[model samples]
Target: MTGTATLCTVTAPLTLFAAELGMDEGRIGLLSGIMPFFQALGILSLPVVLRFGSRSVATTALTMRYVFLGLFLIVPFFAARPDAVFGVLMAAMLGFAVCRSLAEAAISPWSQEFMPRSVRGRITGRMALAYVPVALGVSWAIQAWLDGRTGLDRFVPVFAVGIVIGIAGALMLLGLRGGRAADSNAPRRRSLTEPLRDRNFVIYLFASALQSIVFVSISLFLILFFRDRLGMSSGALVLLVALIPVGAAAGNVTAGWFVDRYGTRAIRTALQAGQIGLLLALPLLEPDVPAAGALVPLAFFLFGFLFQAGIAVGTVYMLNVIPPASKEEYTALHYSMDGLAGGLATFAAGFLLAWIGAGEVSVLGVDLGKYEVLFLVAAGLTVISALAYSRLHEEGALSVRDFVGHFTTGNPMKALWGINRYASRTSEDRRRDLAFQFGGVGSLLAKEELIAALRDPSFDVRHEAIRALGHISAHPAVLNALETVLEYDGLVELRYAALGSLGRLKATSCAPRIAQFMEDPNPLLRARAARSLGEIGDLSSLPRIRTMLHDDPDLDCRLAATSALGKLKDRASMPGLVDLYLEQASDRTNRVAEPRSKVVLLAITKIFRCEEEFSHQWRREEVQSGLAMPQILLQLAGRVRTGAPGASAKLRELTSDYNAEDTAATLAALAELLPALHQSRHRDSDLAVDVLNEVRTAAEPHPALLVAMAAILNRIFAA
Candidate 1:
């Protein structure tokens, strides 16, 4: 971790120094290929690694790495010999790369064999946390020290710092305690070629190898692109280079948890597919474009960030796939393939760039250089790789579409974040918060957590978990648990929560059981049950709910029943509803209109299919008029049904005269229906026979009332 503070990569000051010599893109590619190619060659150390403990072999090789780096640092002093500079520098780098390769070959197997699997991931994370800030700080400091200065003198200080820190890190490797040399005679030992025979592992290796070319070369090539193609200053490029590690740290932090939550293959597929789009966009970001300066660095940042995440998930997947007995062989084989793939392609890309030197290709009239063409090719290859990643088997992993859907669906990540938060937080408020988060997701991923939470000691947590279960759809466990709570749970609140969740889940199978609760002593339980029955959409519960609406003394019971009847859209309930509305409308003792009256009006509108027509919210002037209007309309329909005198003609006139599409129309129709019912030629006929008998007096604001009053006044004077 400390050694990474030196910031020695194939890309940065190394590329900058390589370009300072007269080497073209070809030699730079060759130089970039050196470390990975030697790392690939390090698999030859398997015999040596097996002969000694993993830590011992890795430590010895890493110590030699620093010695080579220290020798490389002295090359700047011999800069006076211009003819020998390239050979001497190459020789020094060759030695350093070989030693580094041997260390690389030993480290993974050592960690796998000796370190606890639980702590390996944590240690990797802690190392990154320690390394990133130092790497960023050191990079900026070096950029400042360089200050656009060129030549061999710059190489000495950078290499010296790396050697010092790297040597310390190497020596620190000695502190790690346990790993035994492999026993050739042991019965449990598996063949080294066992991983090769794994079809899924081979497919994974193929995909990884295909990706490695672009993966390893992208940083190095971008540095050259910025330097030669865009004319960026050497010092400024240092900061640009540092953005890679910075972006990687951010990405790794996010993926570290996500891989565990969601699993690996789906994430890998999503990331690789996303990277394809990024690569395709890169060719369009030419120097002349308005955002190219910013976009280019952004490309580098994402390149590092996304690949770091891929590595994280990929490592987890590999660990899962590898057999317990052959961890060393599996790891070494994987590293060898990765290094070889990266080495060969990077080495080839240099020559390919050299072949296309200072040349341009016109595609759709857009002038693209070798870098653009290479990125296009990389994008094409990435498509194949992403598809390959999709085919890799991961048990219990969601399909790519479903995994991606979590981000777009109702705050699932927040829910996931809460699920992780639950174990650490024991307070009732926090536990309840966890339940709230799980409820919003509406996914079965939270089912086990939410259901287990149902039995939590904290009543708040249990009650909230009951509510959260309503949000997750189609789980037998959730539905069954809720039913048990509703039927048998002692607490009324939990039972109430269960009923609401059943409604949200549309658990129609529970409708009959829920209907039984409508007759319960608790008004709260009765109200919740009625609503759930309505949402479950079982027509059998309609009669019971209508009876509740007609007879229940509880305000909440009536509200829920009326709402249920509305949802059922039952025309049969209209007569009783009109009776209720007329009683409430004419009751002048109550200053404020009752809420049940408004809800009844809404329910009636829904049944009549005129809900959209008279949908404005009720106010002081609107309530009585609104309630009376529907009452009159329902009564007229009832009369027309029974063939009362002039009833059919009156109803036809009312419908034709006022469309019932506006408040004024309803007011006008109510006025006419009042007279037709009140002053029929055959006054002996029963106009109110089919409905409630309490509607003899016409509703107010009638011009006919003035005439009737005048007639009565004349009669009074004559008497």
Candidate 2:
């Protein structure tokens, strides 16, 4: 599946690159459209391929694809006339498409065997990052070589090189040893529609197919629009085309990380925001201006990034909702849907281009070219697709932590709640439930009913009620009910649920009671409390929160405390915050190591206004405690000076007594901290001069750090 998908993606750009060789857009569309037809035919052969064992079938199909691609390169060299060229190109596309389709079908089933169904979406999404970069690089290099050349001669060598790469890629597949076929004793189903009968799978297929239509249309037409109407050169066009892949890569990685850490909701929300931004930005880009030309790629990159990430994340999430035994069939159905959608989109784009007259259209006082209007329509459809996809509730309705905890413990309750209570339910039901329970249900429900739901013997109902309470933000009665649960609930899950619910409700009224959980021996409870405190945005908890930053035994708890303290914007906690920051910076504990610590440091720098005052106080205290070393103190002093708004005199004072080692280390730390501090209304006067002096005297000055420092100073000075 991967190889075939890679081939199809790789070929799209090659066709686009060939279009630059004077092939009309209509012919390019036809050539691009033909491959999917063969691909669809190949997909129908999956039963035979799977019967042969996926690994063997995949390898053989990929090998044949490379051979056909090699043959394709030779066609241009041997064909004497344009008619022959067209015939050969079409034939090559058909053959290549067949091999690709077979490969896709074979691989899709095979991938399910190797990866956990829960994370299949992320795996597929991340895989695109790998394939896209390679595709972009190869396509760009081919176009670069073909620059200033005319005729099929240049394309022959370019495609010949692709053939070589294709061969290498095929050989790489040999490492995947296919497992033996399933036992002959297994029941054989004869119905062709058996797989599509799975309701969840059908919904997933529809969502995936609709999304593909928008994706394929945008991917195929954008390059031509940018080149013709926008007047983008070959080099610029390559870069623009590259953005979709690059953005896709970035979005995929981010989506995976976020889905794992925060859950599917975060990915969904982010995907919506990103897609909307990309959609709105496309028509605004002034293609004729060189400066504006950059937006074409920038927009596509962000669009591809968000859309692909969403697809990848959503796919895995949907897979998680379905039974594992059905994965192969479902995946096959997905690809089949993709082929159908791809065919329809190609045919539609070709017709739309011709119907729209290949020129500008005036809509709402804005002149948009025919292609641009197509993109606008595609973007609008994409938004609608996203909304529809978001509505499908296969996975059970659960908050991020609940979902993670449930999955980690191998519990199905979370999944069930998502499916029954959240996802599959109507929007009216969701909104009504959310508003009733979380919004003001405490006021509406009889006290007995509220208590009964809370104390329900059925764990699933209890869990759902608890989740519903989280959604009730404005209801004081719900807040009170959650508080009662927090005080009495025996189950750890129940207690965590109450805390999480209160937090989401932003029940600041419960802040005092919630603070007691920070001292709970259970690390999970403590972590949840800290997160709730941050969400509540109550400053009263800052002292205890700051203490937890250093004293909590669990790293998760400590990090949560750090996060909470930052959100509270409590500058009085700065001394403790700084201590935690330095410890995190210097500690070798892998448990506490994460990039979020930088965010903590950055947050502290923003809230604290008087670094010089804090440093002077620290120096005095350290001297009095008999724990201060002049060298360490001097470094600390330098950091303070570096952070000051206009501290030339202070920096000069510190520089006079600076030990070489202390100065070097302090300089490095300051180099890191300065920009973060500089951005906080602290850059002015001769602070830049002092930093320059410190940079010059450092034993091992980092060139990159120095450059960053210079850029910071320049921005400050410019402002």
Instruction: Give Cα-based local distance difference scores for all models.
Output: 0.69, 0.60
lDDT of 2 by residue, 574-674 (tens): 55665555555545576544354454544453343333333344345335532223333344444445445344344345446644334355354445445
Question: TM-score of predicted model 2?
Answer: 0.55
**Candidate 2 root-mean-square deviation in Å:** 20.3
Cα displacement (angstroms), candidate 1, residue 288, comes to 4.5
lDDT of 1 by residue, 1-719 (tens): 44462485334777777677666788778777877777675567777777786788888888776677566566566666644666666776688778777787778777665645444444444555555787678778778877756666876677677777777778888888765677767754435578888999998888887777778777568787777767888878887777777767666665655565566788777778767887777766656989777886787778767776676667767776777677777877877888888888888888888988899877789887899878887887778877888899877666787666665646666666676778685788888887887887776667668888888898899888998888877556678998888765469988898899999889988888888898899999999889888778879998888889889998678778877776777777867776765666556777543544666666665654445433432331254433333334444445544334454455455545443235333344333344344444442223222221333243632222121221221122222
Error of 1 at 675 (Å): 15
Q: When superposed on Cα atoms, how far off is each prediction in RMSD? A: 8.7, 20.3
Error of 2 at 520 (Å): 16
**Least accurate 10 contiguous residues by lDDT in model 1:** 705-714
- Segments of candidate 2 deviating more than 4 angstroms: 1-13, 37-39, 75-80, 118-140, 148-151, 177-179, 190-192, 262-269, 288-290, 360-368, 396-719
Best by lDDT: 1
